[model samples]
Target: MSDDDAERPLKRHKPQHEHQETNVTEIERSPDFWFDDGNIVLQAGPTQFRVAKSMLSRHSSVFRDMFSLPNPTSESTVEGCPVVVLAGDTNTDWKHLLAVMYPAICYDLTKPNIMTVISVLRLSKKYDLPAFRKESIRRLRGDLPSKLEDFRKLPVAGWLYLGEVSDVQLSRTIALAKELCLWSILPAAFYGLIESIFNHDGSYRPVGLSLADEISLLKGYARLTRLNTEAPNRAWLEAESPCVPCDDCLFRTLCRSRCASLRSTLQAQQAGPGAVFSGWDENWSDEFCGPCIKAAKEAYNDKQLEIWKQLPSFFGLPDWEELRKMDLDAGE
Candidate 1:
C-alpha cells in the first residue's frame, strides 16, 4: 500500500455492541453549537462550532493546509463530518475569529471591542490570515496617536477604557506590541499604563502590574518628571505682543501664571507631561483677557508640539524619525 493509504486504518469486523456504541457517540452533539449546514466541525476545549471549511480556508492558509490533509479512517468524526480539534485556542477566541470570517455575520472591524480585536489579531497571525491581521493591526493602531499633535489630545479616560477590556489587559497589550514589533504604539501604551497606576492623589496603587512592567513604568516616570519640570522653560511665550500695552500689560504676567499653573497641575497630579496639554480647556480659567488667552493658547500649542517630539525620549525610546524608519525597514 502507498504511504497515504497506509496511514488509514484497515476496516475491521467489529461486534454489534461496539458498532452501536460508536453510532450513539457519533450522533451526540454539543448543546452550545448548532449545525448550520456546515461541512466541518471544529472543537475548542468543551465548545464545538460547525463552520464551513471553504470559508475558513479562504482566509487562512493554515486552515487550508490542515483541511487539505488526507483523512485517515481512524480519525474522529462528528455525525460523519470531519472533526478538527483545536486545543491550543480558547472557544471564545475561536468564535471571535469565526465571526470575522463568516459572511452571514456582520462584524465591525473598525470599532471592534478591544478583546475581539486582540483575538482576531492573535488568531489571524497564527493562521497566516493576512487580511484579518492587517485589519486588527489597523484597529489597534487607530486607538493610538500617530501624530505629534494628536498625542497631546489623547483622552485620559480613553486609556482607562482600554485598561478595562478584560482580555486586552494593559500589561498583555504592551507585551504583544513588543512581540509584534509595533514600535509606534509603545510610547502611548507605556504612558497609559503609568497613568493607570496612580490615584487622584498621586499615590502608587498597584493594579496587578507585573514586576517588569512596574520597573519600566518607574523608569518612564522618572523621565516624564524631568520633562514636566523643563516643559515650561521651553514655552514660546514672547515678552512683546501687539494685543497688550507696554508697561501695565498683563499678557506676559498671565503667560507666566499659565505656565506655572500647568507645572503645578502636573506636580499635583503626578501626571505625565502629556497631561499638561490634554484636557486643559476645562481646567483653564480666564484669568486674563481674550487676546492674552488666545496668545497664550497659541504658544501652548507650539510648546505642546515640542513636548510631543520628546515623548519617546521620556520613555527611553528612539525619536520619531528613527522609530518610523525602523518600522518601515521592518515592513510594518
Candidate 2:
C-alpha cells in the first residue's frame, strides 16, 4: 500500500449501544457561523467559520491529507459536521485567507494591501498552497527589480513607494527574507528599510527595528553616504578629453553643471547609491561631449556594479551567491 493507504483506518463494526452513547455527546455550534451548505466548521480563537472542505482541500495538500484522516470518536462534532480547531492561527488571518479563497467576499488580490498579502502568504505557506504562495511572492515583489541592471534603472520614487508601505510590513519582509534565505529580494527590501529608518535631518530613529537591525541600517547608511559623496570624483571626470575644448566650451560647462546638479540633488534627497547612479543616467546623459560622456558612463557602470555586489554585506547579509545557494538547498 502507498503512504496514503497506510494512513487509512481499518473498518470495524461497533455495537449499537456504543454508537448511541457516542451520539449523545453534544457539540455547540458557533453563534455567528451559519453556512447551511458548508460541510466543515473551523474554529480559530473565538471565531468560527463554516466553509466547504472541498474548497480548502482543492488548494492545499496539507488540508487534503488532514481531511482524509479519520477523526477521533471523542472529538467535537457539531450537527453532522466535523469541528477542527486551528489553535495556532488567528481569526483575522483566517478571515484574510478565506477572503482570497472565496472572491465573493471582501478581499481582492489584485490590489491587496501589504498586510493582506502578508497574511495570505503566511497561511498559504503553512497550508502547502503552492499557487497562493507563489502569487503572494509575486505581489510582494511588485515593481521591485531583482537584477542589478534593472535595479539601477529604478528611481528614488520607486524606492519611496516600496518604503512607504508600512514599517510593520517592511520589518516582516526583512524577517521573512532572512528566514527563507531569499537573497534576490534583499537588496530592494533593505533599500526600503534604510529609507524608512533614516530621517531627513541625518538623524536615525529606531522605528520598528531591533537593536541589531538598527546597527545594520546605520552601517549601511554610512556606506551609502560615502558612495554618494564619492560618485562624482571618478578619474574620468578629471581625465583629459581626446576632443580638446576651451575653458568656456559649452560641453565642458554642461558636464560640470550636470555632475554638480546630480551630486547636490542626491544629497538633498538623501538618495541611496543605486538612486545616485540612476540620477546620473537620467539627468547627466548626452549633454556632455561624446568622449566625456562615454568615459563617465563607463566609470558610473563600474562603480554601480561594485556597489551592487556589496549590497547584501551592507545590510549584514551573506553575499548573493551564498544566499542563492541557501535558498536552493531550502527548496530540497
* Residue pair clashes in candidate 2: none
Cα deviation in Å at residue 119, candidate 1? 1.1
C-alpha displacement of 249 in model 1, angstroms? 7.6
* lDDT score, candidate 1, position 230: 53
Error of 2 at 315 (Å): 1.7
Against the reference, the lDDT scores of all candidates come to 0.60, 0.62
Q: Estimate each model's TM-score.
A: 0.71, 0.73
Please give the lDDT score for candidate 1: 0.60
lDDT tens readout by residue for model 2, 1-332: 23442343222212224234233234234444457888887866666678888998999887798879886676555546666766466777777788778776564324566666667877776667888888777656553445577665555563312324766677777666665445567666767766666665566656676677767777888787677655543423433432222243457666666656544554556544434345355445545666666666666677677777887788788887776666523464
Model 1 stretches astray by more than 4 angstroms: 1-34, 102-110, 152-156, 159-168, 229-274, 279-285, 288-295, 322-332
TM-score of predicted model 1? 0.71
lDDT per residue as tens, model 1, 125-189: 66678998887776566566547556554455553123244322666777766655567777777
